[model samples]
Target: MDHIKRPSLSGLTGKRHSSRDRSKDDAAKGKQKRADSPLIHGQQANGAPSPASRPAKAASTMSIVIESPPNIFFGTPTQSTGALFSGQLRIAVVEPEVTLQTFTMQLLATITARKPVAKDCPECAKKTTELFKWTFITDPKTLRAGDHSFPFSYLLPGHLPASTQGMLGNLEYHLDARATTRPTPSKGAEEITFRHPLPLSRALMPAPEKNSLRVFPPTNLTAHVTMSPTIYPIGESTVLMKLAGVTEKHEDHQQRWRLRKMSWRLEETEKMVSPACPRHAGKVGGEGRGIAHEDVRPLGQMELKEGWKSDFDDGNIEMEFRIRPSGHVRPLCDVDSPTGLSVTHSLVIELVVAEEWAWTKRPGVATPSGAARVLRAQFQVVVTERAGLGISWDEEQPPMYEDVPASPPLYPQSTAPERSTSTSHPHTAGSATPAVARAAAAMNGSGDMTPVVSAMGATQRPPMERRGVTTEYDGPPLYSPSVVPQAVPALNMGGLNDALPRDEDLEDIDLGESMRRPGPPSHRNSAS
Candidate 1:
């Protein structure tokens, strides 16, 4: 029994070592388990760590700028037609500078007349709304700015007060700019917002009226614009006159049978007759020479859209008209003289644009309909009246078309050689000779034709002698004498009859000296 209990010492040692190794392994496993446990930090053992949360963002501010045209020449319109107003304005963007984005500009005229309180609303509210009631008598919002120019030209219908179809009143416009979030928007889609409207008075509104030409409504209807000098040669002085008419009237009569409507026409005529009366251009022959009717047409139309309701016993109705000729129409005198030509500018236009010229009955104060509002029309009536030369008034003459004679054809010299040759060569002594020979012939005759025999002075020499012959210088003679012949050679050569000097040559000789003193002949007379 004692020996069994003792067992083997080596086995006991192995068991102890195995138990120690097991214990160390368990301890290491326990440490790893504790480190991997989710309960410690409340995080998954193998999951990714949560990302750090970020703070929210705030709103941003964007800057915008707009550019527009300059307003230099606004409100100084030189012409106006009843309801037709001709003026230019500058339009541009402010805040934001020039950009590729184009802006749409428009002109608006809001008119408010009499407004009655609504019966439905409470009296207090109705009175308030009625007090500040606003109706667009002439809403010209459709007019857009042309290009990028500021205060761009705003061509608006002269007719205003649509309710009564009346002409625009002494009107003024307020200019402003607006920014839209969605310039190009889809239907039913929400658009981002940007600029509201900022007043651009300087760029949009009419400039100061300091030197502005006055355009009174109704009475002063037509405006004639004459550019300084001539518009043909640019920079040249032109006079551009725009003529217009307005028919406004208030009867002094109790019945007030005043003129209701008015319209005008333009007729241009030219005077062919020269104004040279009593002088060069004034002769009777110059009359009606170049007279003719050039052209005639209406410049434009303006209408009396509306006016004071009843046939007023006072005040005047004025129609306005204007003309802007593109180029030079006629020459102006340097000395302020009149050109002759009367204008029969009498083509009555039954105011087309203006339905009614004048209304005697009280018209409904609201905006007038198309037919009722327009009571009168104004047209540019260019009289084209010519001031006659001097102070006289010349009647305009009809155009005369005269046939002009055709010029004779010029034949080439080569086509008529005989005629050309005859003209070039006459039957003169030098005609048959070549230029060189002609010159030689002139020199050869110079001896017999010696001029002013004594005027030759010291340059003269005795005639040369030869054996029964006299040989003169044959080489191209020196400069020929331009003077008329005075004397001929006196040397006697008998057989040289064929070349004998004529009686004309003898007359030219200084016979007085020769006869006074008979000089001794150096050479004997030549024998045939």
Candidate 2:
């Protein structure tokens, strides 16, 4: 048995298994070390933050609460009283107590250009102007762990340009606030900043429509345009155009300009001065200097081959069309800023007029003369937002108790004619009562005569017997024996009696003659 010592299959298998297990353990240990190692650049191999990495906590937070109404200038810059802006800057402290070293808020007007002089320079692309500033804390102040409010107010000048976002540039207003905490025993100084964008607008009251005229030299061609004083972005604007002096007669042959094609374009021009920062001041000549840039683009356009009434004999061409700003373009309103930022709109109309010859005797027949001319005209248009029902702040406020009147206004009394007294006629033996005479007089006038029949019928009975009312009547019967009775006219009662003519027919009748000859009462009148 000692001659050959061979390892047992079980022992060999166990050794192999132990070796494989040890290798696997070693690999597991290596992976655990790699996982436990410090991350590179604060990230794991997958580029995700490590579990131990955490965001730094802020010592304070800031928020803004606007207290005043919307910022809207009610009239033109020169006439407006400006708009009021009021708000509160709230800071919530997280620590037990924090000492604020400096706290300030600023109202900044920033102008940004899409096309800058220096493309890589931030200052050339954007310029910010400080309109107003508020210093909440000039000295170190302690605040408890709670919310603190700092009220701020400013009157934005009316002349200041409103916030606008244009295709070539942008004008914006911002409320920027910064709060710095004093260095503490356990923490370094921390900064808390808050920024809120504020939008401003101006409303120009509607004025009368404007009429403009342009005359082309040496051609006897003139254009008359009538348009609204103000244009809106969302609504349609009518443009009325009349072209006169289009025909010229030369004895037998007449030359006339015929309208062939017309094109209208609404152009938005944006002008801005791209200022440079101190670092790049030399690039734009010097500090406070900038490169002037102007950009023109069309907001809307249209072409018409035929939509106008042309009269060669009358020597005139009339056209009416509606134009609206493109909503997709988001056209900017008119703005003029002292910071060298301006936006304007102009309506350009181009007409292709071709000359034609026709005999004065035969104006309807004409032939093209192969001579064509292009007539171009431009008109300045004011584009603004709708004023709507929103009036100025001062005008919208209710009247104060001291300013209110003590009592309501007094109205003038109506001057109605006084009732005339009844007078006895000398010719008639039995006269009608005052009511009957009044009714007859009313029928003669333009007054309604429906009450006349009722009034006269009431006179047939005694005043005490009528309507259960009593009154004194010394006059005789309206138709009595003393008065000579005239012949009874044939009554045509199909629709209305001829005796009682309408108001229109009453004008031809002789009222005095009818009143002189009294007629006997009819059976209908007596029954009433």
Candidate 3:
């Protein structure tokens, strides 16, 4: 619209016009510079590389450890109890919440020189190496519940000798690991492994957890042994005995007791009766009846002596023995008889042992005054007769030239003929025969001949001999033969037939009536 001419002097007017134009140009240049800066653009839009393109730093290292329970437990020298031996170690791995999917696990083992031996730098001289092995099914594949069981096993070194003598003091081992990830399908991935070393010392003491099923420590346990009928007959009788032990665990509960098992067998004497005639002097007679009388009496009631409560914590055992007659034993007496003879009989018994049972409250449980030890305990079974008594109903007639009536010998006495002292050695070959004699001496508290000790005159009677036995008959004795019993196949020991002869390692015994002596130590008390 209205064009007005501004007044400008010569120098002032030129400077003002020049300054306005310069300021406008400077503002335009600043805007252009901002457009070229990275702050104004996104990461992708920037020409420089992104942070993700650079390699990441390594994570802090983690540690893994192994542990074991008790070093020893009860075990039998020859048997395997289906349990790991004591003093064995178990391993486990741990991570500090890192990228586990990209990490891999690997194991290794090696033997290092010991401090005492390695001081001389024998590691290189020994030519030892790091060994890698797989056992108990490794590689879990998936890390989830029920995916698989913990596959673990011990590595027995090939070069290490058994622990007897001249063995390495301890063992050394190493474990390795790695991390991995799939960056590209074509190029695959790279592995970064981590190496770790561990050392273990050899066991100088016995293992406490040997042959035990529990993985954790167990409470202290005390044991008590009880045998039924501390006495046994030569034949047709089963001896039932129970071995029970107790454990003290928590204070609120009573001590726990349990039975393990029971096993028994009658060992024949070294001296055997005539196989032809086992009973009478007939063509064939029952075993034991020919030279000596053998009658299998029914099992009697068992009684536990006083103070038996300490025997068990929470455990009890009931056992039985049944003696069955053998068909072969009857054939000895029926060689020329009108009817076939049956001498089959059976003895049945059950033995029980427990791993856990009720506790017998003792004074120590709450007080000390009431504490008492178990002297004896009894577990009995009332057996019902099937065919009734097989022995004769009439009273048994006494044999001629027999000693006064008294308790019969549970074991057969030695009948070895005494040799003349003119021989080279009197103790040789007859050394084992004195087992019974030793027992008799122990019972009589004497070192002299104890087979027969007389307190009246301080005289000893010679042991009886079975060479000649004569009986005077007043008249024709009763000829009524008792019904012979039948034996069950189950009564056979380990499928061995009675007709087959067995090798019995027998010891000589001279047990007689009124001769109270301790019996032989039984193997039944042993822990498997």
Candidate 4:
């Protein structure tokens, strides 16, 4: 056979190049590809369009403006009438006119669990319920370029639980609004959504203080605890405790319990039912089934080795301490929701007591009997926000103008001059008479004789005229003027005469010196 020229297989065979040379070739190829393609490496070529060049999205936005005060339930859930929440939803349209197909808003309550039934499963983590819904636009409506507002008001049910965030779960409220708009009839509708958080709180009016008594069996020891009905998170709460029956008497020896140590802690407990979503319902058994979870943690604590007064004679121990919620822990307030979510708090106290023996004759000298007991007590406590000065919406005052003052205006002081009357008694150039002494005592602020003095100083009726009967008496004076004593000795009791007017000072004094009355007529004859 003639071998016409067997082609060399080496022409089709390849020789491997070094790693560095292969890398350089690859780099050059990538550069060329980037330069030739307009959208390569997330970069645009000179003639290619930029991201901003794409069709514009819907030129409309939505927002909410709360017009009413903060949402705060005034009293307990059973008694509260609920809070009124009013606000306006504003839609700003950039285009000249846009047709809105549907506009609606909803109030949603959501509960989220920190520890779900199934790890990494969102369906077992959160659940949301719609509380209320508002349909602003039922039919397609056209709005010109500007801002349009839709006012909304709702009275939240009083039975609903307040918003709460705990270690195990969270209860929250939100306002979710959506607006659907279509720029062109041929294009699909675009949705604009807005979400806002709504925080709610409840205040339980303070109630009477509570007193609890606990008696330990087999022992006469009794614990009396006094605590406030409601505890505030921001301020301090006082706990008054009295332990009695610590001392036991015997014929020969005395047995007594001595406090060694005491400690207290505030525990916060949270419970939540983690409901599975439709997709994960099989994991929790079936629909409407959920996994119950509970978490307990301490919000605050204190240990006391001392600070208690022990009286062996009285057989009692008294102690008082103040406690406040830990700021660092950010403890959640008490809440009980209808969605199987709840939070509560309790105060736990533990005391260590040891028994000792002492002779009745020498009670001060005692020896430990090596017998001890641990006394534990737990009390329910409410953790809540302070009920500030803010009153409920129903009790709020009517709106007042800015110029109106918070308090009523004060009236101007009286400008009329006061009547000036002399309080000093008048004197005569002689000893004080009985009438004068009484008048002087009355004028000296020691007695009240206004009517008697006015009658005595009145114009004396003519001796011939009868006083009450409109009849005439033409007879001489009933008696001689001599009947009136000229000089009566002044009273000298308890040096009171020094304060009274003297005989020599009578010249400057005038009896019946009132502006409306004339001086009394002299009883002595004019010649004398």
Which is the leading candidate under lDDT?
2
Q: Candidate 1's error at 259, in angstroms?
A: 38
Summarize candidate 2's per-residue lDDT along 46-154 as a digit string, tens digits. Answer: 5588766868778889999999988989888888888888888999999898999999998998988887777888877887889889999879999999999999888
Please give the RMSD to the true structure for each candidate, in Å: 32.3, 14.2, 40.9, 15.3
Ranking of models by TM-score: 4, 2, 3, 1
Tens digit of per-residue lDDT, candidate 3, span 1-528 = 358867658658667778779999998897677667655333344345467555654333334434432112112222212112112222222322222235434444432222222234343113234344333223322222211222334433323211111122222345565555333453445444556554322212122221111111142332232222212222233333333334555555454433333333221211112122222224334332322112332332322222123343344333434433332322111011111111112222223323332324442443222332322222321111221222211122355456557777687675644322221112212332344335435654764432332232232333444669554443222231111112211122333333333233233343554684544557434621
Worst window of 10 by summed lDDT in candidate 2: 420-429
State how far residue 325 of model 4 sits from its true place (Å): 2.9
Q: List the candidates ranked by lDDT, beginning with the highest.
A: 2, 4, 3, 1
Runs with alpha carbons beyond 4 Å of true place in candidate 4: 1-33, 36-43, 47-55, 118-122, 183-186, 277-286, 397-528
Give all candidates' CA lDDT scores: 0.30, 0.81, 0.32, 0.80
Q: Give the alpha carbon lDDT tens digit for every residue of 369-397 in model 1.
A: 34422223222222211222312011223
Q: What is the lDDT of residue 476 in candidate 1?
A: 23
Best by TM-score: 4
* Candidate 4 lDDT over residue span 1-528, tens digit each: 586888887765554446667899999998788777657443367436667676676678988999998888878888888889999999999988889899999999998988787778886788788999999988999999999999999999878899988877889999999988865765667888999999999887778889999888788899999999678877779999999999999898889999999999999999988887777789889988888888899988998999989999889999999887788888788898878789899999998999998999999999999989999999999887776786777667576687466888798796644321222223422443455556556563674444444444353546443566666554333533212232333233544545766556777775643543433467334523
Worst 10 residues of 3 by lDDT: 331-340
TM-score of 2: 0.66
- Candidate 4 is scored at a TM of 0.68
Runs in model 2 deviating more than 4 A are 1-30, 35-53, 138-141, 250-253, 278-287, 398-528
Measured against the true structure, the TM-scores of the candidates, in listed sequence, are 0.18, 0.66, 0.19, 0.68
Cα error, residue 4 of model 4, in Å, equals: 58
